[model samples]
Target: MLHIKNITYRVAGRTLLEETSLHIPVGHKIGLIGRNGTGKSTLLKLITGEIHPEGGSIRLQNGAKLGVLPQEAPSGPESLLETVLDADIERKNLLNEAETAEDPQRIAEIYTRLADINSHTAESRAAKILTGLGFDFEAQQRPCSSYSGGWRTRVALAATLFAEPDLLLLDEPSNYLDLEATLWLENFLRNYPRTLVMVSHDRNLLNNVIETIVHLDQLKLVKYNGNYDFFEKTRAEKLALDAAMAKKQDTQRKHLQSFVDRFRAKASKARQAQSRVKMLEKMKPIASAMEEYSVNFSFPSPAPLSSPIVTMENCEVGYEATKPILKRLNLRLDMEDRIALLGPNGNGKSTFAKLLAGKLRAETGQFAKSGKLKIGFFGQHTLDDLHPEDTAYQHLVERMGNGREAVVRSKLGQFGFSKDKSDVAVKKLSGGEKARLIFCLLSIDAPHLLILDEPTNHLDVDAREALIQGLNEFEGAVILISHDPHLVALVADSLWLVSGGTVTTYDGDIDDYKKQVIDQARNGGSGNSPSAVSEEKQPNSGKARGNSKEARKARAEARALLAPKKKAVQKLEKQIQSLQQEIEKLEIKLADPTTYEKGADYQASVSTEIGRLKAEQEQTEENWLIALEELEELENS
Candidate 1:
């Protein structure tokens, strides 16, 4: 167990946490959630003793081992697997000591200690963790310097998980993961035997893995008894109640002041007025809930587009002609298409999105677009491509040609930049602010289609929500490549699976895709690998011919059998959505100040209704999973 007792932390005179106390029992999975800059990461550092608090103390049970995901990847020529294995510092130290120990008993003691720490299996365990996090066998053997920064970050995460500490602290572990690895990680953490504290913005991950939520609000930590969804509802209720109480107290204070003013001059009422004044002074003032600042904007309506916005026939896309990442792909994007490209990282999802956006040329076959097509493409490197010296106003003005300053400022303001902020250098802006600027630029003359590649990389919850709202209202066709399941589920109407050098429409939703990835990972497939696309065309063999027809027939029969399961899954999806809507409605009613004024009975009834709806939502989700599993079994059979 970890105990935080009245902890206070400050930086540069700003109090991030003050008198905050929390108790996390062993084996409890808790999510540290708050707005982006509210010290979620700092709190993790404090727990690990990287930084000391201004007051109070954090205590862990004696002999407790804690592991933290390092912000900086260890730099060396060591192989990836070796670097991860090095996380077992005690075991490494024992081995080093044994090499120089002169006495046989000392050597024996060291070997015994190594065995106690399971040091013999450390390499294999590290390899497994590396593989699960998207490294292949060859990649894991490569030196740490050979990997890019992102891959190194993943290696760090793998090493942290490999350490198997009693208390693990993970800060946004899912941020670097694709959907497949994220799913695998969720399963891994669900079965984790020790206490875990993670800070994440991934809703699906939090919902599926965490059992408790520790929310940082106004320099205080508040614990919620359930997952992210539960925390949201619980927090909403608390805020609503707080707001109501504040309003009521304000009303009473005003009434008392009015009476005091009227009766203070009357000798008969002097004593009564004095008593009222004293009572008012003694009454504690209720603090209103802190309102979070959020960006508010929408994409401009897209220019008119042809029915088929874009089309590809037998397209091959890659940077090099000799080696294409994807090939023989047939795809079409209609005006109403809202497609999310699903695949592991570096498996041609971004390549496909680029092909659709005209950023990459097809190596072979026809790639056609409607004459009216104009695409707004945002890629992972889009922010990096911005002119750092230019202000937001300058960027907009340059893009808008001769547009008026007022118009440019108005556009920037809509995207969360105020008059003063619009003049700040782009280089000084945070990544999320830069992303917002990109969106603003994209909306100037809205294109017929938008291609977004990892748009939510640096965005906070509010910014992500704003982006979702904008996408929901976008009139143009959208081809999104994102690892965020929440955004994909809410904005994408269809899914395009880009794998095995083939881009095909997936018959199911995001949930179905998640299950497929998880299954693929469990079946010894590196989800990050290019979907086994054969580069060379092989001549048809007699043995292959004998099995081809029967294999085709079997697959057809399986697909046919999958129809009802798919329908069932879709039905459950609708039921879940309906229940969620009903729950949101109930929550909205509870949030209303008038609802609380109706008395305790009314409030209790509203709470009960919300609870019932949440229960139904959970059960509906379970049924959805069953339907999905049935569909998978049929498809795999």
Candidate 2:
């Protein structure tokens, strides 16, 4: 329940939002998206009152609490769990008062409030959020100061989730997360009971967790009633129609002007020419849709090399000689291989990348690469290595050997840099532009192999798409490490798991990996029963010994007691299915071009019906999840 009316904000002599109004309904999940440097983050700050808008107003529902991820990571001495529990100030204050209250009435009121807030289960809830965010139980008990800034930032995110404010604001919550933690967060936010507005470049997250999209384009906020894909399709169709209408209007105007031009000089046709001029003056101009400049990346194709470009045998890699982070990493890379590395953060993915990039040598074992192979490595940390005062041209010049200035400028042009942009200092460029410059520098020689470590971290949705295309077009070996599932799914043909101090071929898709990660989180990290390298799982000895007469009897009784809950869940599932079918039919109607050709009233009614059905479907899904959780609790008890 947030309302932003005619808000105008400006910074650094540039307008980011100009009289743009947006309304977020209660209990709705919205994704705020735009190109990079378009002020998605700035809008979030305006809503949180971190920065005041120059005009208009922003208002939230009275007494509604707001939650935002902390700008700075925690550096205090508090334990991670304590820091998260402290987020619920009401619960903390009430529990403290309960322990010291002398009056019987006051004690009773305090306990009542604690129960209302479920304060007894607060610690477990906080731990669950922390675990989903990639902290184990033991780590949760450690002091926040013991962790790095990135890990501490995760603790701050956990606190925000534990607080469960009425309105939550997240700005690229998955920027620091791996694929596993990103999936967990997507599931968590889908079931969040309050209102949420997130700014993100991750398309999969926006499509999965969000019900609505609010796009910031041309200094305006435009709302669409669907996920990111739906928004894209709908916007494209609208623009096509606008272009067609503009064309037709332009043809009519030209004809009218031609009549006046040819006849206004003749005395006989003067009267008719004057009438035509009036007609032309009265015609209102129809604005055509202007095309925005799209960013493109072109990776030069390298000369074909022999197969098995790289081979590693029993390789151990780490910073310390005695402590190897990745052990027995036996792997091979062919000239045509496109491999995606999958695992959680701090699980040796980056270390493995460094090993391939020649940054680190094998401590013990044979690691070989083709003598003539040239590798282009793009590490996430390399973004910081850029000289702030150097221009893109200068950065390229330093690494471009004795290449001519014309040749260097041409290379920059392939990465979307214009003459003006190439001369701008690195500090003046946006994140995406800087990333493009990195690409230019790395690919200058057209290396035989490419090792990209989190290359999409600074890219927006469009820029990511461009990168996927560029990677596909490049004829060289690739090893990718990224959190963007959509990009990985498109570019990678093989999956490798770098987990549990080893590397292995993962014979499954991203979906399987997602389920494994979720299962592990749900079962306290003991759900690694799935085969790490193969789809077939080994037989469990415990399950074989678990079968007994008494166990069967207890299970039967538990099932009997849980039948009502199961029935409620099934009934809601059927209702949801029915509503989904109805919504699909309405969506199909809306997608047809003929629908928009109808009167505005008719289209409006159709859209209104779809919205109503979707709202009901959301409610049914929530009820089903609650019933399922209750059934699980009963079974566990």
Candidate 3:
């Protein structure tokens, strides 16, 4: 539904996109991906007309609606639900006019449009979108100013989704969400019935939610009719074939040049030498894929120590002595542990990580670690802790404790920083570059334990893969808290549950944890405790309770009883659609004067047909409503 043709955009004397063209068809869910600073977000802005491209055009289908998150977070006195509902401008305007519309014909038109759009369900739909984004019912009723900036941004996202425009644009939507909400959004996008164009770096999201991959490579746009994994495989094959062809052409050119060089001296071979020269001049070289610069995260292996380097028995940790965020944390960390903490945000996962990193003391109970233990901790706030005016070189020199300048520069270079980048101030660096600097700082000493909290928030997919490799190769105990499920699955060999003001050992893998998170979100925040995980594993639990023959028979009987009601609803819906088409055609004929010119009889017959079709339509609609109500009651029962 959207078309971009030969668009060229430049920023700050750097060309990000050069004569790139892309066409997104109706109902296609596209994922726009590229390396960091490759102008993915800039392309979205070009489509939205926020900024005009230097060359070519962008166009959308006529009358098609567009939805995008606002640049700024919503604020002021509006309630969250009201903000979301107001996104559907048509519904809001029609409903407001229905209250004061005095003309009978106008009232009928307004009500008919309302029914067609199912305006009655608007509130529930808004609430569902808000809840999927992690807003509870009470939170939905609160004023927008009551929330933090991040939460306010989520409300803007909720409003955009509730609008359900013909074409939707999302940019790194999952960055603001936790794993639980991310899963919910993934499921929601999988079922979205309209066109979508999203820019994301999360691999799992691209693989699960997108149907097409539109890659920005080599300053141009390339389209692939598959998901990210499929695109990767196809691009690899293409690159190999191109390389092979280029090599063959080079060999042929060399052979032709040798022939010309050797035969041009002889009069008899002049004709053959000229022919070879012509062939060599006509042959053109093929362009192979260029290798991209990759980031390296080679963490130093820590010195070996005995098992169980750290232990916590009935520990309680928090900022306040009286109000502990996490309590009774009976846990242990051996020298070779690779544990991933699982829970929603605001559930004390970070508190528990801080406790392990020696940043917080146990308010109660016993907590002990080896006397010689060293910890390299990376918290979410670590990036903010850097001095903006300090260069990467200065920061390293300060942290490394009077190390040699060459040694410090070499360390920075190992993490993908060049001499110029190392000299740049931290304030001017991009998010990914800042993250690389943090990794470089954290891995200098290679402590006995590593505690990383959401370390992949700014890293791209390739850099994250590098991190996954680095973490697996590191020989220190690790405690990771991250939203990226792929990294967690590949790196963590064990799972730890942090919820309900305590920490415990989870008995399932990452997949099981994902299913649990989705289930809890869909079920209105129920069954999210540690016990829920155990209950899910038990036989005859949840919806499978009472798996006896009697139970099976009763379930079958209920299904049989409700089958006709569903069929009736479906049949009437089809009939209504057919009848509406017929009515429109007949009304078009009645509007023409030619029918009256034929005779009064012909005109009367046409009018009679129109009346009969209207009667049938009204009756069928009533029947459909009844059937739908009955079906809803049966399903709820």
Candidate 3 per-residue lDDT over residues 167-239, each given as its tens digit: 9999989877767778888989999999999998888999999999998887899999999899889988999
Candidate 3 regions with alpha-carbon error over 4 angstroms: 253-285, 402-406, 526-532, 535-537, 540-637
Q: Model-by-model lDDT, in order? A: 0.83, 0.86, 0.85
True lDDT of residue 52, candidate 2: 99
Winner by lDDT between candidate 3 and candidate 1: 3
* Candidate 1 segments exceeding 4 Å error: 265-271, 320-322, 387-410, 417-430, 528-637
Candidates sorted on lDDT, descending? 2, 3, 1
lDDT of 2 by residue, 1-637 (tens): 9999999999999999999899898999999999888999999999999999999999999999999998888878999999999999999899788888899999999998899999999998998898888887778889999998778888999999999999999998998887878888998999999999999889999999999999998899999999999998998898899899989988998998899999999999999999999998888876557645556777766776787999999999999635899999799998767788998888889999999999988898999999889999998778888999999999988998757999999888888888898999999999888998999898888898999988987888888888998886676778999888898777776778887898898766665566677777767762222346332452442342233223434544554467567668879998999999999999999999999899899999999999999999999999999999998899679
Better of 1 and 3 by TM-score: 3
lDDT of 1 by residue, 402-437 (tens): 589888888888898888889999997877789899
Candidate 3 TM-score, C-alpha based: 0.79
> What is candidate 2's CA lDDT for residue 588?
98
What TM-scores do the predictions have?
A: 0.78, 0.80, 0.79
What is the RMSD, in Å, between candidate 3 and the native fold over all Cα?
29.2
Q: Record all residue pairs in model 2 with backbone atoms less than 3 Å apart, i.e. clashing.
A: none
